[model samples]
Target chain A: MREPVPEKTFIGIPASDGIAIGPAFCYIPAELTIPVCAAGTVDEEMTRFDMACKRARVELQSLYEAIEKRAGKEEASIFEAHQEMLSDPALEGKVRAEVEIGETVEQALVKATKELASLLAGMDNELFAARALDVKDVGHRILRILLGLPDTALSAVTETSIIIAEDLTPSDTASLDPKLTLGFITAQGGLTSHSAILARTLGLPAIVGMGAGLLEKVPSGTSIILDGRTGEMIFAPGGETIARYKQIKAKRESHLLSLKAAVEKDAHTANGRRVEVTANVGEAASARDAMEHGAEGIGLLRTEFLYLEDTQPPSEEKQYHIYREIFAVMSGRPVIVRTLDIGGDKPPSYFPFPNEMNPFLGWRAIRISLDEPELFKTQLRAILRAAVGHHARIMFPMVSDLDELRRAREIVEVVKRGLEVASVEFAGDVPVGIMVETPAAAVLVDVLAEASDFFSLGTNDLTQYTMAVDRGNAKVSGLFQPLHPAVLRLIRQTIDAGHAKGKWVGMCGELAGMTKAIPILLGFGLDEFSMNPRAIPEAKYLIGKLTDEKARDIAGQAMSFGTAAEIETYMKGVLALL
Target chain B: MAEATIQVKHKIGLHARPASLFVQTANKFSSKIKVRNLTAKVDFVDAKSIIMVLTLGVMKDHEVLIQTDGVDADTALGALTSLIKNNFGET
Candidate 1:
């Protein structure tokens, strides 16, 4: 019996989003060329070399200036050396001396540059040795000018293709034209690497850190599917797989058109039950974008970003102006402002937050806010001041107990009293909310809902705390499932309790943005769905397709499942139907 | 005639920009400057030529002798020695 053809699917770190299907363009490093020519007049050859050098000089200077503008001075300095190499008389004289002999201009330039490059390459100092590449680059530029050849490399990508390379340096990634290049599949790089960042900026699908051996295993010109979503590189994919990818790509393209149309439309169910799809903005700039993307309101304006970059906390006036600017753009639309949920991953260096072995479970969010009442009062006063003529609401993060909620509410009253005494003409009776992230808070939602105006389910932290799995820790990340039975139970209980007390519940977490989790979330009677601005259109599209009854049924069915896998698999089937 | 022995203190040694900077400095004076790689025991070459200077493969900790033969030879020697000692301002 013959062995079946082995599957050729390679796994890599997904660096950018999107699905790309194209022929592989193997990036072979360009080699310096020198064509042998019959001896022309020595003066003619000399003049040609000089003209080429002059042009090369101008080009290198322009390149330096352009690099300085794009990547800054440090990167531009590399081309400065190239420009100086143009002025190197020893190199130029050797070429002219060769031209003085029988050799043509191209031959002389190549010979002189190669000799110098080889000398540099043969050196023991690794830094000096790398100069060989710089010498070769200068030589290639000048030779290409003389040879009447187009600058290749990036421009060489004539047809639509995926770039398969051992690794791409910042320079290589910078040279790629997004129009011609379909995507990037490099053998080495991380998600945060420059190659990945550049690819993302250009909207090119990218997968990195596939290991260098991947280049040798897959030859150039082979049809491959680079799924950046799943970080899979499938070589010579079967007909079904190709057809499926084509369908997905086509659907995505049309989906964009549909989303653009839906941008101005209300996000609602087929039965006409309106779902308020809002944005989780970080700054005034992002708040404007949220409004443009048809966010009914700002769902979760994380206030931590204001204090993150600065050494000192922002003044009340500074904070008030920022909040006012963001709220002004919303134009009476509701904006839920979450208080500074700093500490854990986002500990500002200036803030003397004690380092803890288990920060996520330790003092963070409301714990810090309650301890530092002065900081809390300043933020609250700013929010109250900005709330004038705007539908503004304040929410506290990591509220685990009724005392924490009451203490935060008391501070809000103190700040409001101060603002009133100053006759600051601010909004009174601003509704206060709390994030039900801790399991204790979720369980006591009925009691807390009475004290709180609303509840925003921070499912990300809720899952982390509930599962006792540090989501940041990769080893146990698989266990940190938002859809796990335990997390789902908490979410269901919180929503029920909030509604029972006549308060609306909203979710502003990774789960809220997930299309797969929408059916269950909508069924749980979630009043508001908040997420990244980019996810609003799709969220609206999916929400419009779902009915209240079907969503409830899906949620009810999901709750019956004992494990997250069961719910996930069931959702996959339901998603396929949709 | 003026001569001075200097060590290549630049972290990257006499490569590219540093070498270009050295050559530019050498060309500022009317002095005919020549450099020899004492570490490699190579013959002295024109210090004003970047390619010849690079060819010497002068690296970090490698000693070199800069000799000048002109009216401003002493000034050239002082400037070149300081440039090398200062690591071409890279460090």
Candidate 2:
């Protein structure tokens, strides 16, 4: 004689698009506790600590192997470093000294790790601060072993269920079992949080920022239905609501299947106009993934990753090999490699950047390259060397005026001459392009196009600079709209200018993949569209349905709209009709 | 005992992978090595200990005094100085 659980519904932000129906697995992690009494003698405590360290090392080895298989070696290196820390004599020596002084093993270990972690945390560097977290994580893992506590509660999920937690850490998301873990619902986090991004990357249905008291309300094992597309969650739903959701889920799955089936097909409009749908990638693995998803080429290959975590600038040989691997993966498909777009938000560890009041508007991108000619030349030399027998092109980021472009081109000429003097083999006919991101660059596209081989509209920065809104700041984020009439006008102007100069125009921004923005960009006669690999199939499918004449009409109407909101609504209405 | 003062020119100083690499290299020879951050003006701690090396807080271009007392002190100093000079083989 059990009372039926009452049906309830909760709304949250839709992070990833999908439908999931499953019982809730309320994940409440067990905290490790230190024993109050010192039960073991000094020698006995030392032995316990030693045994725990040994076990932790074995666990780290396995974790490293698992992570290496799941997410490449670069990520797995963290565990290897943790293993080295566990073997550090100083850490053990500190613990042994504390244990000899009458402190318990757990207490001694905590004190030692805290002291070491604080030393790192006190540094003014963000990378060291992040390492402090790693030190703490390793200490906690050993402490769990010493206390005989089980691993994270996530490992206990044995059945298919929707995970409910306050929030998920990077480690939690990384260890999520794809088969048993259907999706997740979090009481905290925004769309761009680490968990949300990981969920999207893992293709999991997730709804975040569900607010507080969510854990207390939704008990474990309660049958719940969630739509990641609409961000709706139903708890203990009624029969009718369940049926309706089931139908929606079926229809959505079939639609997704159809999109996947047509992934290899070229993007062509109803009026027989063809457009290149490419992908923006950072590394070789992503380039391969993009190719599998039917990316015609790599429109944007961001080169910042090679310089970010290193203790020094990557040498020309190292850069050459890395670029060569990516070129081999792309297999003759054109790759537009953007040279060292560092500074501003992404200052590399090796470089000493001046503290600036306005970093974005200050010395960044091409400015940094032009100032540091040696660093710039090393990268250019690598690109040119790696471009041999590969369809590789070079593109510059954050070009504002003609002076910067002229200097950059002159440097390229210098590098080419230097390579020729050294008898180095390089592709001499590589096309050089400029990213029309700044208002100055967008407005002067005609003049810039004459010097450049092609133009790529970086709408993300275009919107930010044009709207005078910082996209990262929540208060002004609403004004950071790409669909705004002003941003669209800039895009139209840039495309028209590039065409007038007999140069092809491409867009390598988030707007390029958006279903609503595709028709408008098509109407503007953009030659190429580059976006996230996952968005390529749907973008191609949508492009196939729109005629050039109708798309131009829709673009004309969209351009006539006053505000971003009006344009957004109009685009959504237009998308529904197709 | 053999001692030498060398500037740690690695970008991130003695931290993370560099610290681990420094300790691993020091542990190679049968030398009892100790290092102190001359810039930070801290006491010399065991160079073979990653935690001790990290606690020095040696930033880029910070000078560190290394003292090795054992059979292979000169070799250890040469190896350590070369490692620092080469930027921990990160290039």
Candidate 3:
């Protein structure tokens, strides 16, 4: 077979592993169309719409059944959600009006999709927006896979993942097996898409927005590399690239394995300064996972989950019951409770809120609580009521100034007095604290740290805000370096500020959990760490082996480094001494 | 409309898993068809695609999509409405 002078292909950074080879197929989503009536009988259109809805319902049921068979009975519920959508009085009924106007099946589906998308998009709920994406995704996947030509395999290649036409839906993202599948690549996605974030959090490497026609060129099992860090893609790379990649990959693998293998008992610094490794948990499942991973306790139990999950506010009694369950399991380990951190990217359904063009910089966290004292009070009352007998601390998220800090403390004090008057045996004087996530909070750390019993730097937000890099934006993601001198300075400053006031400082961000960062945290004199449960034992092990004196030296050297890579190498060198 | 026959060059053929995909695409417009062959004509398959094209027993070199209609009739016919006209082509 004669091939044209093979166009020299560009290579990407290798993020995931494995090989693939199959007929390259690409899926380009057709823009949806909804009918704007010209002239038609409403009754006829209604009948046709009904027929289409029925057909959609039937298709959805079969899809659900198929998903159930492949996965399990529990997962079948996602499809049931689709079925419910079909019967939604507002959703299906809205489209039914247009269908009653005699829209074709194709037109009906498009109209229905846009209607639902617009409604879901408009909602203040983050979960609603997520669900809307799922609605479009599951429906789109089923429709496309059903109609696609040349039949490609949704069935995965062993050890290699199935890339997609676009980013995967939330349900699909959740269902993937981490080891057997590397993760998906898509032609249309931002770094913040649920799939992208989930993949990153799971430590599965992924790159998005490869543009269209990816599936057409990159055949499955063809020895391709997905470089998530640099956003590079290489196909049929030569031995040099492969060998260079293998060395880096092997070192990284050994690094991860070393974390697990390094697992010892209690955490301590080089000078025998003890550090407690805890997990930041939102659910019972994650709490259980934290205990499994050797977490000392839950650092921040976000009580806002009650508000996020339901159609209305969770009554104080319900909130109390949840707290009792969570704290009881801790077997007396401290559970620091953070009040409602609503608004911005995470919004409540019932709240009348604004969609900020730049959500991270918008009215969010404690700003919302300060502005709406009543909502804040109701939530505070609920937290205080629930945390009566539990190891609890009243923590606030996003406190920028002294007034906000002073006002929040006053509210907590008032609530405690109220609880005491009611003759309730409660943990009335819960340690009140604020997440030092913003630059303003870090800048005002000395004053704010004095008012609170403890400080916890949410480095995820701090890194994003300080660098002015929207981590959600791939173009600037490189700039979201936690090791940036500015960020490092704030972290060091926040820790010092907290300790100067005799307040213990901790971190519950991704930065706190990085294996290399353990030494730096030790140097910073952080007393507690909160991360995913899976990372606890590893963090504990890393911290256990470190000496405070050695860590202090490493941090000093790292801050003076030129690049993040250099800082990592410097930190790794320090860890070697252990 | 004029009809042309093409082979399935993509190897896996038309009927099995690929049929539904072909159908989903075919259903994109308002068109009608009775896909058949030199041997036997299949009548009244759901024009909505998700099932029709897949039933063609479409394998490599198989021919199908005998008839079609609607506004973009010729363009649709030239572009796609006629499916018995591909070889999954080699570049």
Task: Give the better candidate number (2 or 3) by lDDT.
Answer: 2
Query: For each candidate, what's the DockQ?
Result: 0.27, 0.42, 0.01
Task: Please write out the lDDT profile of model 1 over residues A41-109, one tens digit for every residue.
Answer: 989888888899899888777767765676567566777777777878778888988988789988888
Q: Chain B TM-score of model 3, please?
A: 0.60
Local accuracy of candidate 2 as per-residue lDDT tens digits, A16-41: 88889989999876767787996478
In CAPRI terms, model 2 is classed as acceptable
What is the Å distance of residue A117 in model 3 from its true position? 31
Best by lDDT: 2
Model 3 scores a TM of 0.51
Fnat of each prediction, in sequence:
0.63, 0.67, 0.00
lDDT of 1 at A180: 78
What is the lDDT for A436 in model 1?
87
- Report how far off residue A564 is in candidate 3 (Å): 3.8
TM-score of each: 0.63, 0.68, 0.51
